[model samples]
Target chain A: MNWKTVLRLVSVDVKSGRLIRGQRLRRYRERRLFQYLLYGGACVLGIVIGLGAGTLYTAVPDPDLRTLFYEGARLLFLSFPIMVLIYSLIFTMMSQIQRMGVRSSIQLPYWLPITWEEHTLASTLAHLIGVPLASIILFGSAIATVSIYLEAVPLAILTIFALVASAFLASTTTEIFRVLQARLIGAVYKSSGRAAVWVRFLGSLLFLIAFYVAWFALTSGGGSIALIEMVASAQQAGWFVPYVWLGMALASFMNGLLAQTIIFSLASLLFILVLFYVAVKLNAKFGLYEPPAITVSRGAYVPKVGFLGRLGFSSLEAAVIRKDFKAFTRRRELMYVFIMPLVFILMPLMQYSGIYGTPVTPGSSRFLSAWILLAPGAIMAVMLGTIIIGEEGGSVWLFFSSPITARSLVKCKYAFVIIFSCIVTLVCGAIGILIARPSPDIAVVLLIESMLLIFALGAVSLGTGIKGADFTEVPRPRMVRPLTVLVYGLLCLVLALAIFSPLLLHAVAMEYIPLPVSLPKLDLYVAISISAVIALVVTFVFYKIALKNAEEFLIKAEI
Target chain B: MILGLIKPDSGSVNVVCTKAEDDPVAVKRQVGYVPESPRLYDFLTGLEYLDFVGDIYGLDASEKKARIEEYLEAMELEGREGDMISSYSQGMKQKITLISAFLHKPKLLLLDEPLSSLDPRSARIVKDLLRKLTAQGITTIMSTHVLEIAQAMCDRIAIMYEGRLLALGNMKELRQKARLPGSDLEDIFLKLTGTEDVREVVEALLK
Candidate 1:
């Protein structure tokens, strides 16, 4: 391996996102100081944390309590390696799945004079460098410093070594999985033809959902401690599994089983080497694989007006709407717009589902029902509306050159956002009703509030999107200007509050306010009517703003 | 200015006899523009894209069907039209863009590097089609870097330099203006642009 070349590749991978932001720099050397400063900062923070932990351990006063503390710390130290390995594996896998949703990740520089082993090793290291390495440094420093106070310096040194080895093992395993996924996905695309589109979309969606579910399960209330305990037990129970061998070795070392410790340590090192070799081999085999052309329609072409036309849209308006729908469904990057709403729904649903041991109280259930019924659709509206025009990216010139009026463009985009958001709301609302079983009146109120938010926020986002659409698609597409998106989000928040405040006030008054004087109850209809009126006014005002922006957008095609 | 894609600094613009400010949509309806480096929606199949273009131009379903089919067959993209444009070759994408421009049969064609990425036969077909359409009173304003193409295909050529018209005329008038009586368009163009002495630059590079 050319160590220099591998190091260069690793540096490129590490600083790729930074490079996009620091394009004004003529060379990497110009940013070298900043990189060093960041490294120094992390080291300082880690050392500070280490000193603090050591001091905390030394301060345990009572003899019995100190003994308990020492035992708990020893147990934690024994399991730390396995815990790091699990975290590294989960994070690397999540990053890989996220890359699959984008058009391109940090691509391997194939034209460079680098061996497959070097490239694979560099990638493995780079993927681990971000969160995994930083965390290891911090924890390792803490462990070392605390060990001095506990008078177990040699064991702490061994545990730190095991931790590093476990992290490397996890990274190498992730590298193999990444290569295999590329080959498998390429094979599926080549053979599946039209079904490949949905297959890829649904597959990415599944992985994304799994990542979120795993994350929620692991991080929620005492989940991390529970996970470590489970892993510790599994390490003892499943001694044959190679993954937990590092932790087992440390545990054995603490228990004075020198033979077992030496054997497991040696085996773990060998396993890591084997994993690295397998990852390199897989990369060599499938690193250059390209996905085949996806034929969406193979039959003779038929030019009939689609369902959008039947919904009373003009041919021009219907065409734009249909194209936007196809864009969202077919484009990998745009698929996130669909996936995000599902994720929003899934998060709250998981809490209420009793799957993660989260107790669903009456208040929690009410919040879940309201959130599941309202938030996804409203969020989808804001997201979709803000991105609809900018999602055109380069092809927006088609709208500019075509005989499309600004009114038609706004109507088409607004209609699409409303339609798609409504679909999401209905699906999510159905799920919410089935799960939460809210009363009919509450459900109706939730649905109405959702509709109002969607309409008003959709227009608000549309106006903002048109005003600040950024069509640059290098590195990755930034659909809207950052400032514009911020404004859009803020505007949506204000408008959503305005539209929901009446209902919100009624609920708060009923729930919290004492009624010694017998205050008249504000009827649900009255609140909803007020909200609907506010939404209608906001929609009318923002629709005009959106129309004006569209006119300027069509004429100002320089972007 | 013509398509209202960008506004003029200090002057009015009209296209197909419609003032852009007065009725930009009307002007757009009459004009079919193929931009330089045309950015197509890669997610859509070529057929779907063409259908979209047809619908935008208010073409009836039957007309859209006939025209898209004819264009696909003529461009030798019949079987591949169902594939997403993302998977298409550059030449194939150019053909699709050309087809979309022609689908509506607009009164005027504004083409920028119209023959770029085209196979020779496809280029010949486009050349012949433009000639026929021109004869039928459909004006075509094509921009090209290939001087030979400009010399052969154009009745009147306008040479632009730094956003200013340096020369406007037929071959005879261009030759007369450049004072290169027997020289071709390339020679006249190089001379006009003051970049005719490229041998010195080439020698400097070699050295």
Candidate 2:
């Protein structure tokens, strides 16, 4: 087989896909930023830990520092495989699915002169090329640092082999999962019925629950003990048990055992080759194919009664809300936005109930409740605003030229935001009350806090909505990066600090002034009322600006 | 009576003295719309999408089942229906869009670019579909850039370039009034619309 030609063709195809997705330029910038952040964070963390260790425990000598470095390197090496496997698999599959969809790929072998096996092999190799290289570089650097401290050649060699095996294992597992998922989806589609869809969803949920339970059980003390012993026994038998075997082989090699080093390297290489072969065969059989066809019935239009219907919502608005609610209920990604707030509310309540060792204080309860309500409120606002504007995509002209005015459109979007935020906040607040069993005063405080956070989130949403660019045409999934998340988190923190500054100042004064004099209830009530009024006014002002910004965006888009 | 986005209140929009506003959803079911720019869920294949629209229009289960294969073949997209709509080329998407609008045989078929991106083969298929429907006495309103297609295909043509209808008439009368004897439809269209600049641009690109 002409491997070079296959490689060239693969490269050309990869490059073309990258160009189509506008990824070549964006990916370059992303890579540079990622490297900068990773290295920078690592250096800062290392320095902080080193300094803390030096100050707190000075009994350890230079040998201890060397040992700590080796341990850190080993942990990083062990974890790298799993991280690369999950991230590379998910990112590659999602990006490919979004870009060309499953149908296009299914036609690839038929259109091209190459066999399915060859095409699958080339594509798999092309997909793994980036992540594999990254993994190697990361582990290679870590090994080099360790070598400088310990002068161990065998450790460096073994580390490189282990990482390569990890990358292969990750890539293969990902391919298998993708194939399985596509086939399952296809089967569900062929059997068209409401029952089929529900069965599929329930099956997936059950599988997820089972997997998590198994994982928890496996990691628990009883399971871990048995598993560890089993692995130790396997390592003594031979060098094929992966983690334990590799650990033993590497330890032997580090002690200058040449035979073990050579044997370990050969076994690792054979494992990767065999895995790749099997993965290629699987891809040929099932990988390149159309997604399963599922029939969707037009949802019955039930007239929404009560508060939402009375909000002057038009038919289109009601339809959109109903449709979105149904869609989000089915979507796992959106479920997280709902789930996170519940976690925020429940975690503190759990602590208060003495489920976790700590007894929660009143101040802690207030902080937790406020955070639980605020974080999710901000996320929901951002998500709704971004998607509403962005979903227009290449079809903005239809919306613009429609008889519907921009004002009505904006109003509908805001109505969705407000309604969703209120629902989430109220549910979370109810949970908080159930847990804390706070006095009526605390209930009132919770109400005020909820209102304040909602208004603030409304303003934040408008601001971000205006500034954020729509990437609808781009193939990559919409993801808020860790840094952007941190920034948003910091903004929330600053706002919370500003609101509770009076309480903080009161606490400080109590330490100095020596009196147990609490602020009047009336004064606290007035303060909260003023803050709510100011937040509402700001929200209104931002809403106006956001509306204008949206109009300008629509005009500019001209889609 | 249902009113607001689907129907307007304070007035009767009647079909044979049965006010459509009395059952706006039923009215909407009978009114087919091909949006200016159609967006289908990329996750669905062409046949599945057509079946969905058919089901929504309250077609019976047996009818929907029968119609899926019929429309797919009618649209000249029978074999390709298994492929996702997102995988279809521009012309293919246009064909599916047309098929979706016509699935339930609506009384009023609103079409935008019913033939725009189609190749001659697919365009002819769509033209035949339009002819077959209108022969069954269903009214069809469609927009097109190909004046020749309109002249040949449409009984009545509405010339709308910039959100305004410049002319509305039968083919022969409009062509005759333009004072171009024996000139084909393209020449007459160029003269009426004064799109000489566009012709020049096309000529330059060809050159």
Q: Among all windows of ten consecutive residues in candidate 2 chain A, which has the lowest summed lDDT?
A: A297-306
lDDT value, residue A40 of candidate 1: 65
Identify the runs in model 2 with alpha carbons over 4 angstroms from their true place: A1-106, A125-135, A188-192, A195-252, A255-260, A298-308, A330-369, A392-397, A430-444, A466-474, A477-522, B1-37, B41-112, B116-151, B154-207
Interface RMSD of each: 1.2, 9.6
In model 1, what are the clashing residue pairs, if there are any?
A: none
**Candidate 1: how close is chain B to the reference, as a TM-score?**
0.96
lDDT of 2 by residue, A132-213 (tens): 5454555556554545445555566666666566555655655566666666666765675445455555554554444434
lDDT of 2 at A499: 50
Whole-model lDDT, model 1? 0.84
Candidate 2 lDDT score at position A340 = 47
Worst lDDT 10-window in candidate 1 chain A: A19-28
Q: Write the per-residue lDDT of candidate 1 for residues B73-124, one digit (tens) a residue.
A: 9999988988888779889999999999999999999999999999999999
When candidate 1 is compared with the true two-chain complex, its DockQ is 0.73
